[model samples]
Target chain A: MFVILVYDTAAERNPTVLMTCRRYLHRTQRSVFQGELTAAQYRELTSALSTAIDPEYDSIVTYTARSPGMIDSTTIGVHLGGPGDIL
Target chain B: MFVILVYDTAAERNPTVLMTCRRYLHRTQRSVFQGELTAAQYRELTSALSTAIDPEYDSIVTYTARSPGMIDSTTIGVHLGGPGDIL
Candidate 1:
C-alpha cells in the first residue's frame, strides 16, 4: 500500500517518531512522510510506531493507497525533497 | 468531506498556496492543511487552488473523509495547534 504518515508528538518524542518513520517512509516534511509498503511492512511500521509514541499525546494520520493511482499527489512549491531522499 | 491537503511547490508559489489553503483549512504545519468541507465548498476550494497552483511544478494531496469515523486520527505529543486555528 502507498502510505502517507503525518505525525505530531512532544518535542522530546519528536526525534524518535521522525527516526522511526524515516526507516519506513520518506520524510516529505518536518512531520510528514510517505512511501509504499507491503501489508507486512505496514504492520511492522505501525507496531514500531506504537512503541515510539505515547498513545495519549502524539497524532499520526496514515493515508493508504492500494495503487499509485489511488491518490493524487499535487505539488505547489519548490520540492524540498523527493520520496527517495532519506531524512 | 474531511480533507487533508499537503503541498510542495516552488518557493515563490509556496506562500501563495499556503495563504490560499489557510483560507479554507487549518494550517497544521508549514505545508499541510486539513478541515471539513461540503461538496460545493470542496469544489470551490479546488477551483481556487487550481488557479493558485502551477500544475506542472506544484503538488497537492487532498484526503477526503466522508465521515469522522471513516479514518483513524492518532495523536502522540504536545498539540502545536488544533484544527480550530485559522493559520
Candidate 2:
C-alpha cells in the first residue's frame, strides 16, 4: 500500500521520522516516497512520525492501495488562510 | 478507512471530486474530509480527481486504515524550490 502524509508545519517534518520512513520505504522522488508496507509496518511508521512532530501544527495523512483506479482518484489542493493561520 | 488527498494546485481541487467525495464521506473539517470507502469507491474518486487536475501542478495522495498506529505514522512537509518553482 502507498501512504501520503501531509504536515502543516516544518516542525512536524523531523529528521527522525524522515530517516526512519526512508529506511522502510523507497524514496520514489524528492519529498515523495512510496513503498508496500504491511499493516503492522504502517502503524509503526505513523506512530514514530506522530511522536516526532510538534503538536503546534496540524497534520493530515492518507493511505491507499496500489491500483490504477485509486491513483486516478487522488486530488491535491492548497489553501491560503487568514493572517497567522497555518493550513 | 481514511484517505488524505493533497493537491498542489487549486485547479486539481475540483468541485465534482470534492462533492462526490463528500457525498460518500463525512467532512472532518474545512479542507479535511474522512470516510470509509470500499476499494471500488476509492478507485472511482481518485480517477475523477486525476482527470480534473491541470497538468501544471504535482499532487500526492495517501491512504491508510483507521488505526491509531497508522494515524500516528503520518508526516507532512513543504519545499520552496528555485525561481518560478511551485512546491
**Local accuracy by lDDT, each model:** 0.72, 0.47
> How many backbone clashes are present in model 1?
25
How many clashes (backbone atoms < 3 Å, residues ≥3 apart in a chain or on different chains) does model 2 have? Answer: 23
Among all candidates shown, the one with the greatest lDDT: 1
Q: How does model 2 fare in lDDT?
A: 0.47
In model 1, the Cα lDDT at residue A36 comes to 83
Model 2, span B1-87: residue lDDT tens: 555443343544556555655655554323444555677886777676667665445443444354323443332322211113211
After superposing candidate 1 on the true structure, give the runs of residues whose Cα lies further than 4 Å from its correct spot: B1-3, B7-87
Query: Candidate 1, chain A: TM-score?
Result: 0.90
Give one digit per residue, the lDDT tens place, for model 2 in A23-67.
Answer: 656543223345556778877877776677665454434444543
- lDDT per residue for candidate 1 within A40-81, as digits (tens), equals 998898888888888777666676767544555544344545
Worst 10 residues of 2 chain B by lDDT: B78-87
